[model samples]
Target: MTAPTREPANPRFHKEIVSFTRRGGRLTERQQDAWDDLASTYVLDIPRHTSSTSVDPEFQLDLTETFGREASTIMEIGSGRGEALVHAAHENPDINFLGLEVYIPGVAQALVTMRHLGVTNIRFAIVDAAAALATMLPAASLDELRIWFPDPWHKKRHHKRRLITDDFVPLAARVVKPNGVWRLATDWQEYADQMHEVLLSATGFEYSGVWDERFDDRPITRFEGKGIAAGREIRDLSARRINP
Candidate 1:
């Protein structure tokens, strides 16, 4: 395969390849109620430069103000329905959690979970996470980053669209503080292997070159349960950011 191209400076209007695709759907009754009751508190209103998922280049989140206190922040990429995110936030009240997603229905579903769980340490953003990492977040500002079960983009020709690529690793490295840990998991063997390869050689990062055990804090969401029932082995890996 040819070398992967650098993402344009403005990822909002990026060319063909992207880590995620936006999804839309009507919210359910519970979801609507959650949105009505909790969205103002839990969902961040990010200014868009081009589209709904776009984060304005100058728009950096004031997370301390957003969360109402200074705390260690953890960001979960593609936090579908926030099942595991809210669970983790509930378990760790001292830490702040951010769930990044582009799907409106899923964001509302996450709000539904937030209402049921009554967790305040967690918040949700509808911006393109990869773009947020590229320009919106402060350098070395995050304590941890999690990406669980990102779409595998199964076909060989479409692997370029996978989120854990060589080009994407640097953005992750840029945002995570020195010694900050990046935890990722996937059930797709090929995608897991590719993530392993890309992360092992990633600059400003250090890895054991071995798969880590499953993170105990990560709850088994319905999505993960389905992967298990389908007889797929879940691979978990963690890497530490190395300061320059």
Candidate 2:
């Protein structure tokens, strides 16, 4: 499959924008053990950018080989602590789940949880979500894309740092198969509005508005719980790819 052409950065947002900041934290013993033993098995190694031209084919991830068989694939970006991903993998053993997370401790924590639960359908990669989408993932290969409770970047100046942006919408649309769903959730009202607007305006996607029911299968992570306790409304948006 031919990779989709990445769009130019929107002039509305910051020219040099990043969705996440790398933070340092100490890992628990279990996490460290899992990271050391399971990382080679679960974490993908993506090559750094080598040229200014196009993404190198050598760095592309082979989904069929990664999962050991062909199956429906769901990718969750910013899978913090991996509560939702682990639960989804356990519940849907036939479907392959891949998580992209930049935080080291969160990746380690997820590895430990997966080991304890004996889940085999999930894998992870330590990489920027946009970069991976643009370079590594195969075109029209993903069945679903989930972005739950991504960093809001509340400050006006930092809003450009938010993950859901004008440029990212088309990138997501390019990777998802026709009729595949893109699911998103955020507690911040402003961010939710931005997400809705971006998704609606993006070509090849049809906005379905908010989800009718709570995603009960997705466990409420600590961040989500905090948002609930603070009386923040949890907004969900789902869209389907309408163009190939």
Candidate 3:
């Protein structure tokens, strides 16, 4: 299979290549309550984007200060409503989890669920996942990174906006510890194939091929359930960072 390729980042297309669209959906009353009450406690304060090329050092989250103790950290990119993150955090109290989602409602919903479940080991960030991986995280800081059911962007022209791209793989490798796993899932066949091809060609990662099943730590999200009902097959890809 030919390796998937991405267009070179140009100034004009920089923001257009972002993986997510800024969604404007009104939050439900409960979700608003969660945002009002729990945001200060669980939300991460990321530095504002001055330009796509540079991130302020002051904005980078200090892992020691954020988690209050050194622990294996797992980050979920685009953790929609937090089904997987919340469950994983609750199940593994020893592991600290951070979720990055640009959708405001999704972030609020995740916070609400975490609050109700009394989960303390997880935090949510309203930031661009690719940018966060590129600038906010320290090198060799992450134990695991998960990208689940990200937007397929099925149309040809929109494929550049997909989260798993040629450039993103190297950024991910830089942040993830040696042997750290990067797990991804998508219900779209084309996107899955692209993910496989891209990761296979990327340096510092060993592609294990498609996983036989969903990760044991991940729960069956509502979105995945809907995809299953629609007869879409879920595809999983796992890669381990190999070069230190």
Instruction: Return the top candidate by TM-score.
Output: 1
Q: Score every model by TM-score.
A: 0.92, 0.89, 0.90
CA lDDT scores, all candidates in order: 0.84, 0.82, 0.81
Clashing pairs in 3: none
Best-fitting candidate, measured by lDDT?
1
lDDT by residue (tens digit), candidate 2, 118-164: 99898887777887888689889899999999999999998878899
Model 2, stretches more than 4 Å misplaced? 1-15, 50-58
Candidate 1, residue 225: how far the Cα is off, in Å: 1.3
Q: Report clash pairs, candidate 1.
A: none
Clashes per candidate (backbone, < 3 Å):
0, 0, 0
lDDT of 3 by residue, 1-244 (tens): 1111233345554544677656657889998888888887788656565432234645677887898889999999989999999999999999999998777778788878988999999887776776777778888899999999999898999888888888888889988999898899988888889988898797999886655477888889987898899999998888999966
Sequence-dependent TM-score of model 3 = 0.90
Residues 16-73, candidate 1, lDDT per residue (tens digit)? 4677765455778887787888777778877877666778998888878888999999
Error of 1 at 57 (Å): 0.6
The list of candidate 1 runs beyond 4 A from truth reads 1-16
